[model samples]
Target: MKTVYGPYRSWRLGYALGVDPICRQPKVCNLKCVYCRLGCGGIMVTERGRFVDEDRVKEEAKEILDKEKVDVLEFRGTGEPFLAKNLHEIVRALRGLTDVPFGIVTNGTMLGRDDVRKELKDFDVIVVKLDAVDEDGFRRTNRPHHSITFERTLAAIRDTIAESKGDVIIQVMFYKGNVALADRISELVRDIGPSKVFLSTPQCPEIPGLSKKELTDLVELFSGMDVRTIYTECAKER
Candidate 1:
């Protein structure tokens, strides 16, 4: 599979080009999120390793950048981006090749590590996932690895927001499991104080999404913060 793909239009990132660092079959990720569009069939790993060739990624990226213009170069794909140990190296190489800002869509599991945070600072935009506030809600929504915990993930997200030089966006995927905890989730979002908050729901048929009215009700809770919702963006496109 190609490491570089898509100049696809995104609701949050606009016309985004994606770089798949963990370009493996059956997917390789630490979390087995219940609402994951990728589904449950994948390797669950906590340790980071070099999954893709840096030179090959650079070559593909250069070819695409030379030919097509994109709003942002996003590091995300079939698995957790932080699982690739050579992520920093890949990001550094690509940075020199293109002036287009770098972005990453991560689960925030690896942000606890000092090295991870240090390397992530190089990116221009960071979009981290925070689906639930408490342990029960967390486990139910994001069935993470045995080694990962709610407390650690939450703390790491807080620290990442505090330390990041670029825009740190908190992406909350509200579903039947976590909708009731919206107020608490909003409180945590306020406490973390990200550059923006993206409210979303799983688009997959298996996982039901909230109605437009239900999602609209959440807007007031995130008052004073820059907020965007999937529903509102859909309406904008119409």
Candidate 2:
């Protein structure tokens, strides 16, 4: 894919025009989640660095905005967008050209980093991944690097929601292995108080998903919490 990918149908973000800020030779990310769309192979690194040309991203985004009509502009492509150092610059550059609402889909690992959180605070919508809460649960689902811990990531997510000037949507993926964490993750939703929560499962690897009835039951688990489950169907059709 080029610097930009899709105005693809986003079950959550509407028609999203995607911009890839991490366009290196091979995709690099922090976690190897069981449900990743990028397949089950890549470099897992936590180091923050510039991986793409900010000027190129700006040029592509401006060109797209001038040509197509999209419901939202998103910063997500090959890898963890937060790792891309030029993200803030790209967002500012695109903001100068169009008023389309911007959203970012990130793993939430870098939210504790002052620079990452500060740069991402101004987006219109931010999707923070919260697949698991505890260490074992995280290991089963997210399968993050040895350095990342559940407590730090959870705390950073809370901080991001508290400081974000826009909407925050907690994205959780449920599979057979991590299904037991439903209650714990719900408690997190109650604590973080995000505007919305998206519960989904992998479509690429075709993992077993919670049935519709099970999803309904899961929603009931968070009955009184100040959160809404946007996508109830776990096994979404491609």
Candidate 3:
């Protein structure tokens, strides 16, 4: 199967080449997020292994780059890209194969490690998932690995953003469970200082989200901050 899938339309990142760094049949990730498009059968796999071969990934990238007029190379695997031990090697290999800008959509769990953060800084853009600001919210929403606490992930997010060299986008998925945490999430966002904040609802598994009025209010709440809703991008296209 082709590891690199689409130059799919993404409102946030623009035309991009999607890269899957993992190889599991069902695929494995660190979070069993309720809203994951992959569904909740998601497992919390933290082992650092070579999910896919770097040479094969490079070949796949070359084939797509030759045909697609993509704006960027987005590393969004079926699972977390960072969980793959040689992600940086894959990144380096792809750079040699093409000149497209690189970006990654990560769950931010592995960012707790210094090496992961260092390796990640090489990308042109980084989108981190921050669905909850507290432990209770974390368990209910993300269902992260038992070993990783909310505090650790939050600290990693803050620390990574504080020192990240690339454009940082903190994505907060607002579902029925953590919608109330918007204000608190805003507070935390203010403290962390990301380049942009992406407010979105589950586009998969079809979870309940804030109503139009509520979403408008949530956008207003982050008015001072550089916040944008997923729908805002859609509205522009329309």
Candidate 4:
């Protein structure tokens, strides 16, 4: 399989005309979201460490950036990027090699760690995932690893936002069966104080299911907040 593929389709971030670096699962996660494309039965620390060679990724990123015109360098793939032991070094190397802004599409699981939060400060953009507002919705939707607690994940987002120096974008995936706490979610968004929030349906089929009307309602509800909706046409195909 090709390690890298896509200038793919992204409704939120625009075209990805470069190689994106995804990390190996070195740590346990909280969510076992039904929507994961990998279809890994559940969220487990089934593997560890930076699975792909860091040096190779750096080399490849450099080569790609040199050869292609990339709009955004995104960090997201099979697992979480922060789990990579060499994450900070990778961030540094990435910035050194390119002038294009780098971004991370993360679950915000490890953002509580001082080291992790600090390391992420280097990126130009940080898109954090928060699908549900409360513990029940989180568990029902995410189905995360046992080690992950609702309080812990929430805290990570709070703390990371406090320390972050880059642009923060919060992603809320609206799907069926999710009893989304609109008020609570707004409170969370207020707490993080992100530059903007994104309300959209999954690019792929989600665990709970998809709902266009609910998604539209959500967009209207949060219209007061700094946010944007993924173009409907773009999301339909994913």
lDDT for every model? Answer: 0.88, 0.78, 0.82, 0.67
lDDT of 3 by residue, 26-124 (tens): 758988888877766655688878888989998888887888788888888778888889889899899887776898989888898877977976699
Candidate 4 runs further than 4 Å off = 17-30, 46-48, 205-213, 232-238
Q: Can you give the TM-score per candidate against the true fold?
A: 0.94, 0.89, 0.92, 0.83
Which 10 residues in a row give candidate 4 its minimum summed lDDT?
A: 18-27
lDDT of 2 at 220: 70
- The digit string of per-residue lDDT tens for model 2 on 33-86 reads 887777778888898778877778778877877888998887776789888877
Question: Sorted by TM-score, highest first, which candidate order results?
Answer: 1, 3, 2, 4
Q: TM-score winner between 1 and 4, please give it.
A: 1
Give the TM-score comparing model 2 with the true structure, all chains together: 0.89
Give per-residue CA lDDT, model 4, range 79-114, as digits (tens).
Answer: 666666676666677777778777888888777766
The worst-scoring run of ten residues by lDDT in candidate 1 lies at 229-238
Model 4 residue 173 CA deviation (Å) reads: 1.0
The alpha-carbon deviation from the true structure for residue 106 of candidate 3, after best TM-score superposition, in angstroms, is 1.0
Across 133-210, the per-residue lDDT of candidate 1 in tens digits comes to: 888888898898988999999999988888788999999999888898999999999988999999988777999988
